[model samples]
Target chain A: MDEEIRARRAACTDTFLGNGLIRPRELLASIDPETDPDTYGEGGVVTELERHVAALLGKPAAVFLPSGTMAQAATLRVHADRRLSRTVVWHPYCHLDQHEGQAHQRLHQLIGRRTGDPEHLIALGDLEEVAEPVAALLLELPQRDLGGALPAWDDLVGQTQWARERGAAVHLDGARLWEASAGYERSPAEIAALFDTVYVSFYKGIGALPGCCVAGSAADVAAVREWRARLGGTLFALWPAAASALRLLDEGLAEMPARMRHARAIWDALAGVPEVRVVPDPPHTPMMHLLFAASAETFRENARRLAEETGLWVWPSGFATGDPDVVRAELSVGRATLRHKPEAIAEILSGLCM
Target chain B: MDEEIRARRAACTDTFLGNGLIRPRELLASIDPETDPDTYGEGGVVTELERHVAALLGKPAAVFLPSGTMAQAATLRVHADRRLSRTVVWHPYCHLDQHEGQAHQRLHQLIGRRTGDPEHLIALGDLEEVAEPVAALLLELPQRDLGGALPAWDDLVGQTQWARERGAAVHLDGARLWEASAGYERSPAEIAALFDTVYVSFYKGIGALPGCCVAGSAADVAAVREWRARLGGTLFALWPAAASALRLLDEGLAEMPARMRHARAIWDALAGVPEVRVVPDPPHTPMMHLLFAASAETFRENARRLAEETGLWVWPSGFATGDPDVVRAELSVGRATLRHKPEAIAEILSGLCM
Candidate 1:
């Protein structure tokens, strides 16, 4: 490949694979360089950003955390303490269970009861079947790894009420709740109000620098703040990344619905491709999985090659199905990715398969 | 107080309490505002900063995380998984056990055996008494809440060997390791080499933005990276604040000893004060506590008032002594806080007592 093409391919792949491409010139235009550090400290810009997020989510307060790991762990820890129970109930595929290095288990000693069937979203019936006394029931809206499937609105409300009746707090693992909101055709506040606490990320659908916020009642948030400090989450200084998030919050949130619409269109277009199979067909949100009649290794190699040739990037690996010859890839249509039409993406996949 | 004075007091208190004030100008000056998003992410300037930290700590790689909570929790989780043991041993005052809301217990389900007397630093003899099969022995170099005391160097090495003999990993809770290194007259790399894993903070003695690094053998760090991502530590980006830490790595590491020297001097001077009694007298590191002839509430109120009047901030709460009239205050002498001479701080305290 020519050097220029390789560089382009690398740039495109880096953007699509990571948080997104940071255009140096564009970012500088938005923020004042001189005040970045101080603007992120106590009573600084990040604090202001937290207030904004709290209000947006209909919560009394919010805190900007460096990562979702600490934010979610801290939130769940508070809930467990308040209930005086160490058991938290959630789907088996919940991020806290699978991704947190068992932090929920290792750091907090909070036991988990996987309340739902593995293959589906948590239903109201699933909540009723859990045998253990749960301190909190975590709901992942538009569940990832399940092709962004969401329980029906009434079912979600019913499940929340079910947990409440049993004196369990409901936490929405809304890491992707931005995208899920579009699927539910509700406002962010509407979705947020359904749970006692909600965790939202700046980087996922919002495309900002990495950060997360946990929003809840004043007392609960104050308790989380204390826990945050104890856990060393209270940094002496925060980067003004939250400033960038404020901008993304304004820019990307409005575009999420359009991205979700585009995702459905992409699903429809790709369904006809002989070599492509999507899970949870017609994805409920702006994300979906594309299974290909190729090994993961082969798919990645081909995807890399295609990027080199076309300056576009697509994931080529995901959960394994039964067949050794097949591989899955997540297709997340963000604002930038949506620039390339669904038909164009389908055509690229078709070319690669051929 | 006049509004202007009140504003000045708040600003000065914020500066005194802030972590990034030491080299804020130089730190902010080095950042490239023109970068797109102007935030931290892979391949961003901040990633370069983490790379520099990894090399300085003699680890194969390092990642910039938001807080020590995630860093320590993630590090311990990796050790537990590798050893298939559920227990971690540490002093009762260790940050993980006391400060993290039992996150190591509640979130990770990792049991902890408090190895030593709470009032003293963990010695080799203390490790000998831990009967359970532990996954890791967590050592806090220059123990904080216990007045920055350290076990003898040989004792630490012996403890590492002791844990290794039992197939357990050794983790150093080196939040104050920078100060501890100066007191021990040892290099950071030398101290890091004694353990399977070590966690260091950028904001504490280093005076950088809030960030931490976990260092170990290549395999151990790789395992931590996997856990980091699983715990949502791997977000969209992490670059800017990490860059600030990188800039401070060279500038701040050497200044710890001066701070320690100042702390010792401060302790010596305060010892002569009629109403003040120093704990762990003569100082082990750049931190000590003053047992005051006042109540905790009175100390806090006075400290807040001093902060308001003198634009100086000192910790106002500590252990309660047997006497109702006496309270303790932790005195941490950092690079910036040491700007005012020891006599000046002691004189301020003497006046406050009168």
Candidate 2:
């Protein structure tokens, strides 16, 4: 953001948007001052998080990791070592390809095979075409890049079954699993049961500190823990992250349904705005992509105007689209978004079009 | 520890030994409750720390890493990439060889070549034997595994000069550089200037949260920062760790000289005991190894008796030596060790031999 918008954002009395910015005072406020800390990834709050997540996901064991990149790479490497195959299958838009700097191939020597099309997720047909031996298949629920899309329950089951028939391990990139549970109206354990391993994020949707948990069978988890030490994720004290996660997790779990409901309300409210288009019409999870019927320059002007007049920071920038006149923005309806009425938010967002 | 000993340790108040146990309240208590936080390893407190350490070490830049394992590996990898050589030379008992799970070899595809005798720190004579091209030579200050030994200043400069003459980058595993500074009676920057890059720890001697910093030229630090992101050390929030390090680092730095003096006093006191032998005599740093005349079993019995009678937790176990008749224990004197008079501590330690 430029100086004027930055100043306004800082001075704004209350945020109409929240990324759960972890201010030191705010982040530790929820944790006990005298809480016992963990040592070297074992005991204390780290163990508490591991056990809580394992039981919540109905897994025999779980290990809290410092990040998801290490968690998934280490998990997949374990599966590869067991199956004696280095190939992993996932969507073309998977995080391993785009965000992780290809750490799997560089660090683990595991080959990544993009099975499904980039514009869509893996279907049973996509899995059938993979005739070669595969170590594992990774699936992201409510695919964020696809505007929080989710597969039908039957399709999801069919896809997992196909991977199993081929003797391949199945893993879930359940970073937003809480949202998925709310979307499917099913318990997290029910959805987690179909996978060989599941990785969940505490910071993204939950608004807790940065950390993640990988849950699976005891042996797999033990293997991952060993890998965690090798990757240098086994810290001397993980209590700060673990304690924050433990304190806010149940609250996040309970609040996700409401967030999902608010997302739908947002879509309904936006339908009246002629210049805005909501992906999937209604969000499958708590997040969605909004295509604006305005140029990037025009969107900036509208945003700046709203910040000056309404004293609200809408967005710093909007992503450019293929067409010069259109722009795209992603909206993940959080507690802050819930505070303002959907109609009021839509009214402010419409200004971005003009 | 067994149930009884564990209970005793828990109940004991005000220890004569400190390892900076980072209980949440105690760790964060020093920071302003209203301080802003850093995001993804950038800005706010992490920036403050990076700048502070860089200036202290007289380096152009520095980047904070979650663990020393990642910090050194990433730094070595960058040096290797620049030099196009895979082999890194260090002592046989270097952390990379003894502690890490061979991550440099496993993850970075970098070969490690031991260059010195396990019993001694690397000397100029050791550097002369290296015929093949090397990417880097890692030297740990006040080598912990070797009873906190620091190379003589002239010899240290000569060794680093030899590595540079061979077109190899010199890296300092300055994990205990604070103590080394006290031992050498020189500024940290004075010693750091002999190496191309230096990695320092906060949790070990500083009593801060678990983390470390690699300081060097701007280009090298920028590269390590990229690797940190790929390694997943770049968290959504690093404020807690950075803030803790920033708050406690100066105090730890200031305390090292006094701790070093107290270490000398402890050695003098131990001289009066017949069964206890202190390594390096007067001490090269604020830490040393204590060789006991008793066997492992005898040491445990004496330790138990002391804890039960004195209500002070002591050694739960001691290392078995080749003789099996003698045991060894390491002591890194800190603020806690300084609290008790050196004579009193030696009197207590002497009982373990009986």
Candidate 3:
């Protein structure tokens, strides 16, 4: 059944527990064509969104790209070129390693040196392990795969200082920066100030259509725009995605603090369940991994049944962990999760575990 | 002023000569949300369009990319990897060289060896001059920069055979393949069948949303899909573009033959105008360059005046040729061009030249 749930998800009209973002039809319907006409990778709403994002992140400029994979790679390539070094230091479980098919090396000729354990956050000690000159240090705002874990504030500052001392540019993979912002109690600009470059996804925390923007110095962003054109990220029109992002950003960004609070309450409710475990103990962001002490087959059966009865899409089977008896699913609090009380969601998860 | 016309064109509600493709708002309105939803660069209308394009070009498979720049680079990189040679041979005026900011060399580590004069099409003799092992030979059908010129049929076959004998991949930059097909009086598949890989643009000749597809063997297209993800071209949703392309393709592709006929008629009407010269003398494709003896400054002034008075956008200033005096503009026949009689368009152009 993975195919079965995919089919069901396509047909299901119910609000679900996945990303819970607005669907494309709703997004397209909401966009105002008169004000949001197509832009050839520049000007109009696309440029406006970029400027708005740049100011929010306290950067000199920003360029919109279609994917984080391209955004990060292009940004790092810019940093690498500036420093005249090809080596990039990042965590072992970074999106670049897990998802992008070694694009940094194959496409951009940038070498990656994994500097941290896959199960933990990168430490100052991790940077000390690299014996050679590095072009850039890439850090995820909250380590995603390890269940939204963030290093101590002191460690984060020390890591940036170390990279700067070595003349290495610091880049943040701030894919969920909006959600991560609340836990830090700092504006995006305050947090982004530490890095030389930042990559943020609109589809993730902003709940917009698929696209991303890289923020940095004007020169850096200009270089990224050039690379974006080269990488095919600069479409003839980015207004649809930009308009949706701007609208969703206006609605959702301000609510992130509340969503983070709600996420903790849900975890609190689920803490008593013996068969369920939330990664990172107490959530640092509005996202966390839920480990269920149930077999994949059993989990799929319960998930299917849950969807059939409640019209809720909790866990898609493809996200299961390596062990057949243990499964993992990520919970990213959104409008749908806010609709239900913590007790109700906890009970549903508990039932699945049982 | 250029700025004045840009503002006016944005506000003017008149049909124009440039491109004359479907506007974004109109295209967005035409899309069927009930039948067309989001696809993660996978199934739905996106896949159907890819399959349709693949069949049209007689390729085993096709993958939609967000831009032609990404499509061509990814395809070339794949070919280079397969042959273990990074040198690609093409004309100096190819889009990869002049337009893409040396992305092949900078991003993909591919060395480009420019062959033939920039003013003419590449010949079999041009390939014989390359001293190194070439991974791919990229040919632009109806060379856009050279006034839509195409080599003789035997010469075209000879060039492909030369590349094949040298174990080099032959790829076509068929941005205007639809128009080029009419010139050849051959089906797109018949022309594309001679190459190892073909890149087609939806926004150009097809007048769809900005996106392209690289069609070839299953393995080759699969490799392109991988690079697409790596390059950040794999959008979480491409249905908007796919849906519009599918619709526009159904509407516009059948009219390409007629568009070509209309292009010839326009050229025939302008033949006697001494101040105007159509590039490639006897136009080879539906698209041809119109070189006006008037200076670039005068041309822009005339274009702005014409648009103000007649609500017809002839060409933007950014497309002007290198020379200050001899202005060159490309005309790609579309629905809007079909609206005016050939004599009317010729008279309008002749006035500008004067």
| Top-lDDT candidate index | 2
Full candidate order by TM-score, most accurate first:
2, 3, 1
User: Between which residue pairs do clashes occur in model 3?
Assistant: none
- Candidates 1 onward: DockQ, in order: 0.29, 0.66, 0.60
Question: Which lDDT tens digits does candidate 1 get at residues A18-85?
Answer: 23454543443344445434332366567778889998898888888767877888788899998868
Per-residue lDDT of B17-101 in model 2, one digit per residue for the tens? 6552235677767566665566577677888999999999999999999999888999999999999688999999889888889
Which candidate comes out best when scored by DockQ?
A: 2
Docking category of candidate 1: acceptable
Model 3: lDDT of residue A149: 84
The candidates score, on chain A by TM-score, as follows 0.91, 0.95, 0.96
Please say which candidate is ahead in DockQ: 1 or 3: 3
- iRMSD value for model 2: 2.2
**Cα lDDT tens digits for candidate 1, B1-354:** 334433444355433222324434455554455432213235555456667767766777776676788789878878998777889998888888776777676445688888778888777888888777889999988888877888788888888999999999999888888888888988887888888788888867776656788888778877776666645555555555565566676767788788778878877778679788777777887777777788777776776677677667555444577787887766666756566777777877765554
Q: Is candidate 1 or candidate 2 better by TM-score?
A: 2
